[model samples]
Target: MHIVVCIKQVPDSAQIRVHPVTNTIMRQGVPAIVNPYDLFALEEALRLKDKFGGKVTMLCMGPPQAEDALKKCISFGADDAVLVTDRSFAGADTLATSYALAAAIRQIGKEQKVDIVFTGKQTIDGDTAQVGPGIAKRLGLQLLTYVSRIADLDLEKDTITVERRAEGGVQVLQTAVPCLITMLEGTNEMRFAPLENMIHAARYPVRKWNKEAAGIEDVTKIGLKGSPTVVSKVFGPTPRAEKALMQSVEDATPRDVSLNVIQKIFTQHPTLERDILAKASV
Candidate 1:
């Protein structure tokens, strides 16, 4: 069971800044951490690898600094880490991201068949859950998003059963292997890396791949050129209308406020008073 977990390095939301010229996220200076949701997927992959007695590999596509995120996964018990970084991969949206990830997985498959691929439900910056499904579609893998728990695993049958989160409740679905599963948040706690694991991560030689190295032959298919959607503008949050006015009464009795509110309402709409009086019993 060789499981591949796809993780991402994201800017700490509290430290995020937008570039004035490009209107893009200013990633420099701000510290980056593994996408919070990816931790759930990584932990689940590690747990499954522990039970099944196989290897787990962590993969990510981001700037060169993203190697830190891959190393962190090594600290959490992943056997190998692959970092795909290149200027060609910059400015990638979900569609382009999925294309690159699926390509990397294909290259990995050439070495050994991957049993499963794992991804987080969404990223804080993107907040779009489309990438996982896009990857699944490209790879022809079964797409399982918002999975809450692994109900059962049958190695012999090459099948996995999981409880998926839905609008009202959970849905139990059984799917074959070589599938992609996106773990839901708060499903499982991430394991703390021990002293030995931490040391291993510090010493691990992370594999880096450039555009050609990651097997990207088409220049237009790996970055913004490959993305279908374009964000025209990014704006600050809009303020809501309506304001609250509190009376300065010392007691602030409900009766007084209610009467005052009624007066104000009737003053705005005089017919409201007639309608309310007609409807009232007394």
Candidate 2:
């Protein structure tokens, strides 16, 4: 019942800034924190560990500074932490990242059998929600996304059940061991690290691995070379010159105000009325 949880160190979105000239993110002054969404995945894994008495390993692919993020997970009860960092992995897109992470997981599997892999639904910076599924695809693991709850687990039978969040409701799913799960945020809260664990995390020797150590066999499948997706530019949304129209209902009855707003909308967008009528008739 060994679980591996993937996390990333990302810039605080509230404090992040974009360079006007280069149209790139300015990370120089921004504080890096563990991806908030990943915390949910970590908490879920920790909860399982508490219930089943297994090991939780924290894995991250980033610069040397990302060791801090792994250490934080250690304080939260992860048994081991591994950092996969290399210059060759720089500028990796989600595809390349998944490739590298999959390689690292393979290496970790050699040390210990991994029953489950956990990740956040999406990272705040990327927000693509692709890496977890990509890793699952590369590793041929059962991929479950947007998981809201873990309903049951049977170690002897190697079966697990979960509730997945979907369009309008939750979907109950059952899968076997060696599966990948992307946990939905707000499903669980991270626990506070006790003093002993905090001390242990501070002294923990987090293992660092380069591309070679991470079991990456192909040089052409990592970093900028392997990244096919190109970002042409990154810029903030343009500000609209017009302000929002404010309608006052203080002097009018609710029905009268509703009718007035409806009339205005119909007058401004004549086709909207026809579209609504058409849909209603169907």
Give TM per candidate: 0.84, 0.85
Prediction 1 TM-score vs. true:
0.84
Task: Name the regions of candidate 2 deviating beyond 4 angstroms.
Answer: 19-22, 238-282
Model 2 agreement with the true structure over 246-266: per-residue lDDT tens digits: 667888888988998999999
Cα lDDT of model 1 by residue, 1-282, tens digit: 999999999888889887766667777799899999999999999999889888898889998879999999999899999999999888898889999998988888887799999999999878999889999999999989999999998989999999999999999999999899999999999999999999999999999988877777677887989988898887755456865656756767878988998889899999988888889956
lDDT of 2: 0.95
Measured with C-alpha atoms, the lDDT of residue 174 in candidate 2 is 99
List per-prediction Cα lDDT, in the order shown. 0.90, 0.95
Tell me, by TM-score, which candidate is best.
2
Worst lDDT run of 10 residues, candidate 2, spans 239-248
Candidate 1 residue pairs in backbone clash: none
